[model samples]
Target: MKKRGLAGEFVAHLFPRVVRGENLRLTYTFCLGGLALTVFLLLLVSGVLLLFYYQPTTAGAFSSILFLEEQVPGGKYLRSLHRMASHLFLILLFLHSLRVLLTGAYRPPRQLNWLIGFALLGLAIFDGYTGYLLPMDQLALWATQTGMELLGTIPGGTLVKDFLLPDGIGGSLSLLRFYALHIVVLPLAMGVLIVLHFYRIRRDKGILPYL
Candidate 1:
């Protein structure tokens, strides 16, 4: 209990001072950013809960999802929350960026944070797309194949697609690859980027005021 209390204190201490001050307020300053973070935390929890029953194989992927929806306790609710939270996170992230842009907070030292924010947004979108394919349902399979074909239209797109789907779309290799990225690689990158984003905000003394 003592250790838990210490950890809580450490996390509490990590919050940027600007969040504690009413004087630093803007119309959408804390609301959008805080909501984005909150929704992401929900996604993380629900995603972890999902992993216990999820199978990443071509044959088992869709069946596992159905099992989750119809069999496991609270599985349907968790899946629903995960799906909705994914969509909501993107919306709130975009609004957060819009708020920064409208406030001209992207100036000077904050420019790097803006770039990082954009990267995080792109990764967030890609994260959602990759997770969408984990079910291996008809919509998921065709949507992913269509996306790959679209990628193939670009220069070197075939090479990229070959690398991603070396065993071809709808194959076990493709499913495994997407599963790894969805559950591991992309989330790790996002976690690093989020830490740096908040660290910069605290380092810069807070979000910049209007120009």
Candidate 2:
């Protein structure tokens, strides 16, 4: 047999050669993790498309969104798809986490994968929150301000708030920071965590058998 190349080996590692028959049942896993991943992919594509038109500035952010919705063809649908997928991704992650917990899938060798999954969920939530401020609308402005205030109330969270909003609130610098985090930093981190999560799952012998 020909030895697989690096790309082929990586693909094989992700796809795996064997899946137990019991794991095929829908009720066993509810496919929540798979669904979340699908939504993440959707969000990625739509977000990239949106990036072509989005402006990362307090002065132009909301105007650019309006231009996309009213001037760009099919832009409204693309934005809506991304927004809906973001919401669905979070929901699916929560349900998947609950399923893992109830099934005791986090026990033993699966613990590391569980931690990775938890971190991915957190990144997803923060990604959504960061995106919330990119539009620079009144709702987004007040909501982010409220969140920043709440963060200041927590121990050590004030430092985080300061780091994120160094120039007070709702300015060009803060909007740019949120835009960078939403579009670049958070997604890249989540992507890395997802790869590690999958590798851990395979190493741990796949998902736990149904009870």
Candidate 3:
């Protein structure tokens, strides 16, 4: 009883790898990707929690925000966490891409990963934009209005705006569509791209310098 062999002894071997940082590659863009991932996790946790009580309809949206602000126990904390995580994601994504470009890491072999990262960045923006609409308050309304109007100026952007514009309201966007795309499509695409991103890293770049 209580004896150990190769399997149990493996626990002893585990500590040094982590301690010596052998457990994983540590590269500049990879580190930033990890940080962005952490932020995304925070956003997800806080967002789902908010979703429990959030109402996306025009009639209920502002009230839900007030409830979050005034009634919920940790509402402010959750709001702040979500907000901060969103900002951090933007920062981290930018830094990660910039790091790759500056280091020439995106050249050959890794070019597709960089392209995928760009797509993911756009998806992340859409995710944030969709989430922004959940609040459905004046600010979110005005923001979406501004966004769509600006988008309308792009080539074929008018068609895009028409596709997203609300049927019953003159000034509102489609809450259901945006929410579905955010909670479903964009994240799914990002997840796929993320798997490929990591795979490319391992296959092409291997590990970073340990020192």
Candidate 4:
């Protein structure tokens, strides 16, 4: 027998051969978590494609989007894929969370994974919000401004608002900040949380055996 290499060993360790048959059923966990991860990967790829033409600035943001839609080949579809994937990612995560709650998957050893999952959801939402402002259209501007104001109403929210929008929505600095968070900061944080979430699942012996 040929010995497995280090990478093969790691893969085997990550995904053991034995899994509960019930966990494989379509109705077991509904595969919501897996679907969410797939959509996230789609979003990441399409987002990178959009980044090629997207201008993160107060002056050129809207025009850059227009250029992407009208001038670049398949740019509209790429953006739409990213946008739709973002929505689907959130929806799948919400449903997955509901499934977890209903199935009591959050009990005991799995509680940490539950928190990590929710944190990923929150970051995903914030990532969407940040991307929403990148177009610099009137609607995006006003909508993001309204969101910032609402955020400010919460205690200690003003600090977050200030950090995110020091010069107010649509300002050069604010647009830059949003662009950075959307493309860089939030994605990195989400990646970290996703790794931890998966690790926890592996540590907890996977998916709670469908209750």
Candidate 5:
């Protein structure tokens, strides 16, 4: 109780400022932010668990996935959960983008934050594509191959094709690269963008027209 009081007193003494309801965007913005954070955390945890049992190359991936789903107890549940959460994350990411567009939330001081949101949107979709390739099932193989062909038609696709389906791609190697990108590079980039997003919010709030 004493500690609680001291903490509260410290907060009060150091920061007496109050947030006015009208000063912020509509309630929906807060709701959207909540959805974004929830989905991102879901992806992080599920992606980590998936990396434990998955192999990336074409030959072994199918068997490894089957092993996780059938042989390992509770593996089916987590794999299914991960798949569902991924779809949900994409849906909500799209919704968040729409919310910003409709609200004109990118005005003036918020324009750069809007760009960050767009980048996150693209990353979310790319994450889905990368995940789809990890299983190396017939569906994964055909879909990825078709995607590569489609990109191949576009200019400068030679560079893009390397990472999408490198020459040495097989079961274990591709999975490792996919896992590292999903868990390491993409997440790190997302984290940095999220921080920047919040920092910009604080900066904009200072100059925003108060109601």
Candidate 6:
């Protein structure tokens, strides 16, 4: 006696007719993934708001951030929230990953999902790094130069660093590249991976019941 409508079916698929350990208390079961997802959602909201005022140009980047903090209403709060959320998101995800490892949830049918989670972690870190450069302050400039130097130390990474920082660290081109990746490519990739990660969890019968 399942209902049969497009929207209903979609919702049903997401919620599902059954889940493992449904009778157990939620706090007693695994919920780190959900916590990580919530923090990521917060980051998304704050990041979108920040996009309205952030300037990607090397010359304007720092000034734009300063103006936001000093002039725009609630801008300082939003920026701080965004930055804090970035750190919290990573922390939660790391805990989630560690929980998975400690609970044996990364085995067998769940290995692929673990890999997807790792992909998300990598993308999130890269996104954070790119954001770090958007402010174009002296600290950001030095940090960016150090990052590029580290990248150059890799065998084939010099080409990528050159292409991304053609005019060197703190250059307009590098700033623009980081801005695009921060605001566009990495976010999109992470979004897709997140969807896949959750889908796999739902399909694989949730978080394996915390051992």
Global lDDT of each candidate: 0.82, 0.84, 0.72, 0.83, 0.71, 0.81
Count steric clashes of candidate 3.
0
TM-score (all chains, Cα) for each model: 0.86, 0.90, 0.81, 0.89, 0.79, 0.86
Quality of model 6 by C-alpha lDDT: 0.81
- The per-candidate count of clashes, in order, stands at 0, 0, 0, 0, 7, 0
TM-score of 3: 0.81
lDDT of 3 by residue, 95-191 (tens): 9888878888888877887898888888888788767766777777788788888988999998877777755222334876777776778777876
Question: Per-residue lDDT of 79-196 in model 5, one digit per residue for the tens?
Answer: 9998988888778778878988897888887899899888987887777777777777778767767777787898899677776556534446555677577768888888677666
Better of 4 and 5 by lDDT: 4
Residue 174 CA error for candidate 6 (Å)? 0.8
The best-first sequence of candidates by lDDT reads 2, 4, 1, 6, 3, 5
1 or 5, which is superior by lDDT? 1
Better of 1 and 4 by lDDT: 4
> Which residue pairs come into collision in candidate 3?
none
Winner by lDDT: 2
- Residues 1-211 of candidate 2 have per-residue lDDT tens digits of 3455444543555475766786677685567777787889899999999999998977889999999999999999999999999999999999999988998989997898899899999899999999999988989989999988988899999899988998977888888899899988999999888767765665576664211
Local accuracy of candidate 1 as per-residue lDDT tens digits, 1-211: 2332433433543552334355457664656766887888898999999999998898888999999999998889989999999999999999899988998989987899899899999999989988988988889888998888898999999997887797987889888888898989999998888777775665554643310
- What's the alpha carbon RMSD for model 1? 5.0
Instruction: Supply candidate 5's per-residue lDDT for 27.
Output: 60
Model 2 local distance difference test score: 0.84
Model 2 Cα shift for residue 8 (angstroms): 7.1
**Which pairs clash (backbone N, Cα, C closer than 3 Å) in model 6?**
none
